[model samples]
Target: MNTLLIFIGCGLVTYFSRASFILFGDRVKLPETVQRSLAYVAPATFAAIMVPAVLGDDGLANLVPPSPQVGAIVIAGFAIAKTRNMAVALGAGMISLWLLQWVGL
Candidate 1:
């Protein structure tokens, strides 16, 4: 019962917070530079999350020997560069990782 109530409270908070933007967006005018900078937010956020996970605690040291993960990232990068398709890049990365792991790196 307590958990359910807590979840409901949290959900309502989140909903209201997000809805506030839509409710008041017209009145809140941001600067052109701020709006332009917002475009980089997603990619920056993605890199922030992925960099730590990919590099792990050892950081750049993990790239010394070129692990399966690094190989997959390289393949995925190439796929995206060549095809310009996110799905293809994802598939290429996943497949390369699986293959590398299966072959014992």
Candidate 2:
């Protein structure tokens, strides 16, 4: 009974918090700097996640030149930027990596 009540209370609070945003957001205009910063949050966050995943050794930062992952990243970035197609970029990058590995380069 106590747990059920607590769950209901939490749900009501969460609903109100989200509902408040929709109710009041249209009336509020964020500052330009904040809006601009918000625009970068996604890409910056993506890079923050991906960079370490690509470069980390045992989850530690390892910055070295001629890294194959770096080459794949560059190719992927170019493919995505030019074509704006995630599937194509990923496919091309994976194929490229396989080729490089097979050729022993």
Candidate 3:
């Protein structure tokens, strides 16, 4: 019961925090620098996640590069560049990885 109340409290705080922006956007103008920084957050976050998955050894340090995974990432990057759609890139990357696996990569 206590845990549930904590979760509900957190959810309400999150909801109100976001709702505040919509509730007073016109009156509260963010600084240009902050807006610019916010614009880069999505891409920066993406790189932070993807770079590690692509470069880091699955769990431990390994001298050899995982070529199959890298190849899939490259193909996904190309799909994103060309199509500019994350869903398409995700599907293409998943298919590429599955095919590579089935082919005994």
TM-score against native, each model: 0.78, 0.62, 0.67
lDDT computed for candidate 3: 0.82
Look at candidate 2 and give me any clashing residue pairs.
none
Q: Per-residue error at 64 for model 2, in Å?
A: 4.2
lDDT of each: 0.89, 0.78, 0.82
TM-score of 3: 0.67
For candidate 1, write residues 1-105 as lDDT tens digits.
699999999999999998986888899998999999989999999889877877777778769787788889889989999999999999999999999889987
Give me the displacement of residue 82 in model 1, in angstroms.
Answer: 2.2
Q: What would the per-residue lDDT of candidate 3 be over residues 27-70, giving only the tens digit for each residue?
A: 98899999889989899998999778776666333215455677
By TM-score, rank the candidates, best first. 1, 3, 2
Say what the RMSD of model 2 is.
5.0
Candidate 1 lDDT for residue 95: 98
Each prediction's Cα RMSD? 2.2, 5.0, 3.1
